[model samples]
Target chain A: MFAEVLTIGDELLTGHTVDSNSAFIASKLTEQGYWVRRITTVGDDVEEIKAVVGEILARKPEVLVISGGLGPTHDDVTMLAVAEALGRKLVLCEKCLERIKAFYEKLYSEGYIDDPSLNEGRKKMAYLPEGAEPLENTGGAAPGAFIEHKGVKIFVLPGMPREMKAMLEKEVLPRLGRRKFLQRKFLAEITDESKLAPILREALERFNVRIHSSPKGFGKYIGLIIFAEDEGELEKTVEYLESRGIRLEEA
Target chain B: MFAEVLTIGDELLTGHTVDSNSAFIASKLTEQGYWVRRITTVGDDVEEIKAVVGEILARKPEVLVISGGLGPTHDDVTMLAVAEALGRKLVLCEKCLERIKAFYEKLYSEGYIDDPSLNEGRKKMAYLPEGAEPLENTGGAAPGAFIEHKGVKIFVLPGMPREMKAMLEKEVLPRLGRRKFLQRKFLAEITDESKLAPILREALERFNVRIHSSPKGFGKYIGLIIFAEDEGELEKTVEYLESRGIRLEEA
Candidate 1:
């Protein structure tokens, strides 16, 4: 299945934070056989977030993974933007309210907080898009979300790396089907890629392999490396190129 | 002025490579007073690249910095996608060809390459979008590009971090103007953000300062931070909050 990742935060856009989140999520999705088509990062502006959300949702990829903007702070607006894009209302989820209350009460008992009463900032965390199921968060205060809006399966994740990983593994992956991809890397001792241009083109048309050649320096020749569907297909590709006199040494 | 970054690569989309190029560019742009609005990554597929380019260009940010997919490999279609997005044709530029020739000849003289003749793979680097001015590459064969298309100043940089940084510093920065942002972080001993919500909201409305509150765990409180346009404004913010009985320790 094709997928897309949308991460929201001004820190990422301004270079205050590195987006290790997208890479981590995309890799996990790739391991599950999903082709992540895009990873987009936008700031915390409501209009910008809503515009990007609407644009991405319209494309309608099978899997849509969203991270960040799911907190009690002023800038945390991903949930609100998603709800606006889906034309849904922001309503307080009862389960989430209970969870937030319990979390705070437990903290109060442990001398973590001065009081157990819910404040506007903390209470706001419980307000999710209507009909959205709260994805449990064992490591953080804001609960994640899993909602299928307009037939698009979305996994709303927190920006904190620890919480995002936990929610995706324990809550999201178990519900999705899996896929696989076969890939191989090769290096050759040839000086010119033009010498094997025709062979590389032929391999692409013949075996349907997605060809990617990394030519280092001026005269180095290519050993057309490919990502095929299976080991048999990759072997067939190697044989086809070798038959064309393009001997490749695996790197 | 506002800006955006578009990074092109299949390796990045599939999580085979972590994209640090956008952050580098974004941080540099931020230092120059440009507010980077977004950073988007797409695969090597020409259609995908073209589509994203079109979408980004339509928004028409003041500055657009693109990195990656500028090499001679089969997957390097970023230049072609950009040309199509601007409704331009791919044409060979004499300067780039000369640079490529000189680059290869140097490699040949240094015993790096078997021959100095331009191969099809190497020749492809010269065929940029028509009328594009080639940026000097001190670290590689592929030259970057700086073109003003549809009123947006676009810099098409190489995927290699070394070459991208050199071109941006030497060729791009000197011609552009710079802006500045003033920021301050604070640590507080308060447990509830609701205690300071009214004052923080007032600072946002009274001044243009963007306030962000970070709340950690149950008993701990928010560390209110402010991003102002000048040091004086930041100082005013610190005084304003402290005067309201909201004690903040500068971090």
Candidate 2:
């Protein structure tokens, strides 16, 4: 199945931060046998997030993993925007509120902050789109949300890499089931680049593998990635290419 | 003015490569005073690229910078897709073809490749949309394209960072004019995270500066970025935040 990744933050748009979150999510989704079709990034504006989320839903990807904009700040409005996009209301999760309270209290005890109380901005983290399951965040204060709408599994994650990774490993991967897609990287040596194209096209026609090739440099080698469901299929594709006078080396 | 960035590559979607090109483009565009509203990454499929390009145009952004898929491979179809998106035809750019031939000859002379003659895949890089200006790629073989369609300054760039950066600096930024936006970073030392929201909100309302803040850690500091047109506006906003008892340090 195909999936999409959405990352939200004003800092991302302004070029203050490089968006490694979407790449991490895409890699994990790929490992789980999902084809990540697109990755979208938007600013912190509610309207922008809403418009993008709606558009993604209209495309109907099987899974959507959104990261960023879930924090105790004014511009962290991803939850509200996501709720609006799903035609759902923002509702408070008391359990999430309690967890947030304990999180801050532990931080205060460790002398990280002055206050342990939940203010309006902090309490805002407890609200999730109605009917969404609260995904636990082991590394941060804001709890993530998981919702299944219109056959699409939507996951809302935090901006921080540590928190997002924890939630994705603990919460997201488990829900995606046990299927896996194997991807192998290779450097294909071919002196004439034009002749390589027809061979690649033939490989696609004769095999059940997806091949993606890009020139490594202005050289004789092209980077090739073959994705297959099993090792035998991957091996057969490699053998077929090698028999066609293409030298392949693991990369 | 507002802008959008679209990066095309299958490797990006597969997470085999992280997209640092968009961030570099965003930072450069921001410095030129364009609010980058969105960054979209799609695979090397022509239809997907066309769909995303159409969507970005419908938003009416003043500038659109698309990177990647400008190579001489079968999947490098960004220029063709972009031409289709704008309802234009892909016509041969004679100058670009000459440059491509020269580039291959140079590569052959340097012993980088076995053959210097142009092939079908290499020839494809010389085509551009009808009425579009070809941007020189000093670091690669495929030349970029610059098109102005319905008030949008659309720039198609190569995926290679060196080539894209050189083309962007020499070709894209000059066309975007000289309007510059200044951005300053600070670490705002605030003990209570929630209390800093209203102060930031007030800073935005009272000044022409745009403020973005995110927690540095579960600690007493928050990362802040202030964007403005001049040094005076930026200084005034920083001073205003200080007056509200928020400690600021250059970061």
Candidate 3:
């Protein structure tokens, strides 16, 4: 399946933030056999966000994952943009409100804040899409939301790495666990590409592999990847490469 | 100005490669007042490359930067993809071939390789899109290519970070020196969002600044960013916030 990652924040565009969240999410999705076609980073401008979202949706990717803008402030426009793109309505989720209230009460009891600020923090996380499923936030105040529209699954996640990771692992993974996947990789120590050209061409002919060669400090390394339905076909391909003196490393 | 980044490699999609090239390019582009609206990462698939290139052209971004697949092996299909996307033909550049031959001859004279794969390496990098301008590669074997199509400039660089960075710094930055940019950032001490809400809101209204709060650690720290066309306006905004006891620390 193909996916697109949208990382929302002005800090990302300004060079103040590194945007580790996209890399993290892309890595996880790729391991599960999802092809991340594009990663778009935009500031908090609603028009820009809406425009990019509309463009990505037109591409008809299987999934669109967005990270950022789930905060209590003005720059938190991610939900608003998603709603605008999908033509949904924004509403206060009562269950999310209750959870936020409980979290605030715990913070109050622990002397982390006064009652006034606690209430505001709780209210900050109460907003959600009208019919979206609010994924419980065990790591932070803002709960993530998941919704489906036009055959594309949209996951709106917090910008914080810890919070996004927890929700993705606990809530998102289970929902996508049924998708079958095959992971294959090849490693070669040859530095010169010309020397390995004939071998790579032969391997490509015999196996359904997409090869990548990266030049490292010591030598150039090549990676060959393939996806198969059954373990038998996967093994046979691995054996074929092994007979040709290519190392099929475990991914 | 607007730009789009294209990172090409199967390893990037397969989780074996983390695309630092896009982030680095994005940072540089943003610094130069060029907004990087979309970044596409594709495998070595020629069709996918062509599709993304078409999409990028449709967006009419002022600049298009692509990295990877400039190697000599069978899997390196960037030249072919670029030719297909721009409706051009791939032909060997005689100047690039001569340079590569000279580089390899130097390496061989130094006893780097008795039976050098110099011709193969040169052949891999010599091909270019018809009428494309060559960007000098001071660091590696693969020289970058630059082409202008329908008023949109397309830059193709090798995937290796060292080569890409060198070309960006030496070639891209000089060409982008004509644009003016204003970026102002403030770092504030960690505080709860609720407690700082009133101050932040007042600061935003009083100075017309945009604030983004991100929780940092046990004590939450916030980052405020303001963008403007005039440097004097940005300074005045910063001064106004500081005068209001917002404790602005320049970042």
Candidate 4:
């Protein structure tokens, strides 16, 4: 299966924040046996988000995970943009409204916020695209979204790492089925960096595994990662490479 | 002016590596007054790289920065893919071959590598797309390439952070003339996060500034970043936000 990731935020485009969230999402998706083909990052404008969502849907990936721009600020226009891009209208979910109200009241009671009533910006968090299931946020006020549009599973998550990680674990992972892919990292002790290329090429033609290699340094070791659907295939590939006189140790 | 960053590597797609290089390039481009519109990450496959490169060129960005896959491994096919995408041929740079020869001999002298001979894989690093200028790699062996195609300045650099940063600062930045953009961060003391939306909207209409706000926590302060072309406009926007009763402290 193939997947795509879209991360949205002005801070990302401005380089004020490094996008570690996309890598976290991609790693989790890869573990679930989905080959994440692309990861795209854009700013918090409606037009930009809509255009990107449209382009991604045209690619027709099986799973699309989108993170960031789900807060209650003026720049948090991801939900609206996603709705418009899918040709759906933003409809208020009553249950999400109740949850957001409770979240704010709890904060106000703890003397963290000044007001408990839901203002315009707070109320905006309760709306999602039509026919979307609201994904609960355990650590924050804004709820995530899960929608299936034209056979693509789209998930919109919060920007905060804490909320995003919790929702992805409890809500997102459960929806995606349970097929796992195994990947192993190794350090190949090859003094001549260029000499391992032909051996790697031969191993790829013989094994049903995906291999990636990079020079760790000018030293005797290079980094190698082999990915396979099962442990047996992974072991076979490793054995084949070792038999070719390229010493490899688990890294 | 607008720019785009495309980072190519299989490790990034597998979530084994985080893409800090894109952010570094974005921050530098933003400082040079170019809005980095998007950042894309893909694997090392030739077809995938060619497809993505074609798409980015179709967008016609003023500048495009591509990093990674410029090594002596079998998987480092980025140069070939880029050449094919642009409908050009990979031509050998004689000076680059001489430089590569010296580099390997030095490594052999230092006992870093077993062979000093110019093998096929090592010799592959000397080829660049026809009609492109070679950018020196101060930290590594593979020389970068710079090409101007259809009004877009395309820069191809190595994936190693040390090499990429040195090339970008020395070679890439000098070619891009200096016209700076200013950005300032602040902690706006607003207990109700939603209430600051209208004030930010008003500030945007009154001043030529871009503002991004995020909730720091449920506490009194919220994070704000204001971007402008000049210092006077940035200061005016800050003063206006302060006058609207949002206490802002430089952060």
The candidate that achieves the highest TM-score relative to the unseen native structure: 4
Indicate the docking level reached by candidate 4.
Answer: high
Rank all candidate structures by their DockQ, best first, as comma-separated numbers. 4, 2, 1, 3
lDDT of 4 by residue, A1-251 (tens): 78999999988887889999999999999888888999999999999999999999999999999999988889999999999999999999999999999998998888888789999999999999999999999999999999999999999999899999999999999999776677889999988668899999998898888899988888889999998888888998899998999999999
Instruction: Sort the candidates on TM-score, descending order.
Output: 4, 2, 1, 3
lDDT of 4 by residue, B103-129 (tens): 999988988887899998989999999
For all predicted structures, in order, the TM-scores are 0.91, 0.96, 0.89, 0.97
lDDT scores in order: 0.81, 0.92, 0.75, 0.92
- Which lDDT value does model 3 have at A87? 83
Candidate ranking (lDDT, best to worst): 4, 2, 1, 3
Clash pairs for candidate 2: none
Q: Clashing pairs in model 3? A: B190-B220
Better of 2 and 4 by TM-score: 4
Candidate 1 chain A weakest ten by summed lDDT: A216-225
lDDT for each residue of candidate 2 in A1-251, tens digit (9 for 90 to 100): 78999999988898889999999999999988899999999998899999999999999999999999999888899999999999999999999999999999998898988889999989999999999999999999899999999999999999999999999999999999666678999999887556687788788888888888977666678889998888888999999999999999999
lDDT per residue, candidate 2, B1-251, as tens digits?
Answer: 79999999999999889999999999999988898999999999999999999999999999999999988777788999999999999999999999999998998899988888888888999999999999999998999999999999999999999999999999999999776678889999988667888888988898898788888776678888888988899999999999999999999
Interface-residue RMSD per candidate? 3.1, 1.4, 3.2, 1.0
- Please tell me which model should have the higher lDDT, number 3 or number 4: 4
Q: Going through the candidates in order, what fraction of the true interface contacts does each contain? A: 0.59, 0.77, 0.37, 0.89
DockQ values per model? 0.55, 0.74, 0.46, 0.84
List candidate 1 segments past 4 Å from native.
A106-116, A184-198, A215-225, A229-232, A245-251, B180-198, B213-225, B229-234, B245-251
TM-score for chain B of each model, two decimals: 0.87, 0.95, 0.87, 0.96
